[model samples]
Target: MNARRGPAWTNSITSTVRRVLAPLAGSGRGIFGTAALLLLLIASGYIGWAKWGDIIVRRPQYVLTADCIEITPQPPWIHSDIKSAVMRDGSLAELSVLDPDLTKRVVQAFELNPWVAEALSAVKRAGKTAPRVTVQLRYREPVIMVRTRDPRWKGDCFWPVDTEGVFLPPEEFSSTQTKAFLRVEAGNSLPAGAVGTSYGDAGVTGAALVAAALKPVWSSMGLEWIIVRQELPNDVGQPMEPTYILLPAGAPVDAVAARRSGRLVSLADPPADEPSLEVRWGHAPGREAPGEASAAEKVARLHQYVAANGRLDQLPPTTVVDLRPGAAGTAVATGRPAQTR
Candidate 1:
């Protein structure tokens, strides 16, 4: 029968042991030789454990606590501590750094935050002093504030929503912060749904798209509200269809300066005497009438007009500047004072 071969290192150790103990056994000290050999093995094991046992053994120090999870910095609009919120809400206050699925669990936890549109990735950064997991995420930003005619919402109050009409936390914005966003007046609609959910109103959704498109130049255009009108009172013989109107601020104040200085041109303030200026934005993008100009074309035309007239409000008040294909920039006098609400 062939002798079973052990590892080379083990065989070498066995040979060394036999050579060292052979003298004691031959000297009639066999019991002492065995005891000394056992002591040597135990001492070697203790030294080995002291040198490298931490790497082999798991401990609480090696685990990931909530404080060890780092999130990428969020935008100014994000007021809540996303890391704390996610960890507490997800019940992931403690996680094992050695867990094979650590990164996956981290991603899932961050996704639980309503403001987090997507948790892109989580990477475990193994630091000698302390380990940490860094997470990259995409956040949903509020594009516009929508005001429905719902009686439940008091006085000029609005709900902030993203481009897709996803409602954002209202308390996140102070009264001063709200002035930074454009407003959409979705007349005759209900209140917005729960926070972080879609507002679920078609008019509000369409109005949101228009608001987003107008956001860049809204103040420059001296605009205050994007009104979603189902029908125009002036269109007596025409069929009723959804249309958008850009209502410029009543006063001829410096729109750009007002916005930059954090001042709002109050609709009911001293500008009460001036007639309202309305840019008749015919339809929201992609829903234009067959013969009407495309949204891009309309915006270009409006910009051209603004370039020449200084701003949309440069036109006489009580005037409606049509931006559709056929009636482009033809101002119609409404012959009425601006309504203050």
Candidate 2:
């Protein structure tokens, strides 16, 4: 076949090697194309190293500051949690929030509030000397855990609570009562460290109203505590009286946060930094076992029933009175079977 083209000497391995290496830096890279490629490679390496430099070298003198969760006494629950300030965003305690080099660190320091979702924190100069770090709080819906169950629950006695559920101590509820949180009837039955909170359903109904905007609704309703009588439509709530607002159980967390925010906005002139309220609905507004009222319909009925009989205050604080059947003109507090869902 034409003498095999003399074994193709033009495409020899030596020639190809020279062609490839020819474009790269040879002995003298002080010139054009090769030098440009070398420079570009160096720049790429430098940029990558700079961006990821923090991973290896850490400095202690600088720190991220003002990244803390706000807690108050009224909720008792809140005060208990915020005993010590912990950094969210993963920043150290003493660092400045505005250090140009620590911008990334500042973004990582905030210990987000359970209700705050889209948190943004920044550092600004305050009157010249000290650095003032300002943080805008974004509240997210609280989530609870289920540690136990009660016969009263439809399935599992879900303790619908806020996000900080696990971090709370049982004693915190001893003073303020955590009943409005998700019901974990079998506290012992719960797996190790498993908590029951209001993360799931509309968070014990009224417990979701932690912000100041909704103070007006609570104020208008004169509701010292709000208890959600979580009920299925066809069964428990339908037969209740017309005066009660029968809200469905398990409202969306986002919706609850929005509603709470809206409610805080409604308060005539709420302070910029108002404390969290001890708000919930089901339990009696007392210290002792005065009987807990789970359902709004049942509570209204119980209220009417007790009004007819004048024994409302005498009911045990933990008892949830189910007055749906014949409570119209009766004052008797009937105990229902305990079924922990």
Candidate 3:
């Protein structure tokens, strides 16, 4: 080495370089071995988790049992069992709390029930021995009753509907229950549909809105029937639509008599001399024709009359009240009491 050295600085630089690389000399195999081991360890871990991940997550604490699912308090009108209805088909069987779609699945399950108008939220309470799911819901409330002439049911029968004209479970209404709500007489054109389904009739939907609006004063006003004119008036045209008339009670309505007698009494037209009053409610709320006052204005006009003359029944018989705008006070006339078929 001494004889081959060209310069002292070059020798010194070579020595320094050799010392720096001394520990790494012959360690290539070791580095390669360590890398291979690390890769093997990583692959094994992945494989192990892949094989047993489901089992680990399926533990008692991670499972969402039927009993653990909770629903928010429901209104008195909701007669159906929400939980039973939602899970009747076992749609959420074996669902896990850690499921990526847990909230979505729970919401979908609740939406299937006719009573649930909307699923507000679905929250999970995890980290417990039994994880829990809490669901917030909005339910449909029966606002009006629809008297249907369906051939399937004998005698007088009525179907309850929500404000949106969505059919409710008719069986939920008892005779006493039926009397508590306003009723609409949609003629033979009333088509049948499943629960939670709309009647698809503009008249029925309109009637529902009117009924809801009248519910506060229904009893005080002595109102009975919401007669949906099957035959649209010949005068019905632009700025004018089919009419909905509010008739005061005590006009010898057969439906009323049938319920009283508990018998199937045939519907017949009332006597020509029967004492009655007719309130011409133009159209559905927010659906007023051109030149017609808003629904609120019409309602205010109606309330004004009732306040002045007491209930509709207290008014003179055959009195006609037009709540439309620009109409004067109630007009007295003579006509047959409209029949509610």
Q: Which candidate order results from sorting by TM-score in descending order?
A: 3, 1, 2
Candidate 3, residues 1-341, lDDT tens digits: the string is 56665545445545655564555555676776566556655665576557766887788767776787889877887776778768765477677787878989999888878788899999888635666789999888888777766567786787888888888888888877887788777664354678878977777888888888887787787787776643333444433344576777665443422322221111233422444566767677877767666666666777876765667766656566667543444332233234310
Q: Which residue ranges in model 2 land beyond 4 Å of their true spot?
A: 1-62, 66-76, 80-84, 94-96, 99-127, 136-167, 171-184, 191-296, 312-341
lDDT of candidate 1 over 1-341, digit per residue (tens) = 99999655556666777787778778887778889889867765576557655554356776667778878898999998888888788877566677678889989988867798889999988776567898999998887787544456566677888877788888888878887877776654554567768887766777777777777888887777776666533446664456776777654323322222322222333322434566667677778778777777777777876665656555567455567764554332232333310
- Candidate with the larger lDDT of 1 and 2: 1
For residues 35-149, what per-residue lDDT tens digits would candidate 2 score against the true structure?
Answer: 6666655665565557644542334422334423232222323433332333532434645434465534543443333323334654444433344455444433333333444
Displacement of residue 236 (Cα, Å) in model 1 is: 20
TM-score of 1: 0.66
Provide the lowest-lDDT 10-residue window in model 3. Answer: 258-267
lDDT of each: 0.69, 0.35, 0.69
lDDT of 1: 0.69
Error of 2 at 184 (Å): 6.4
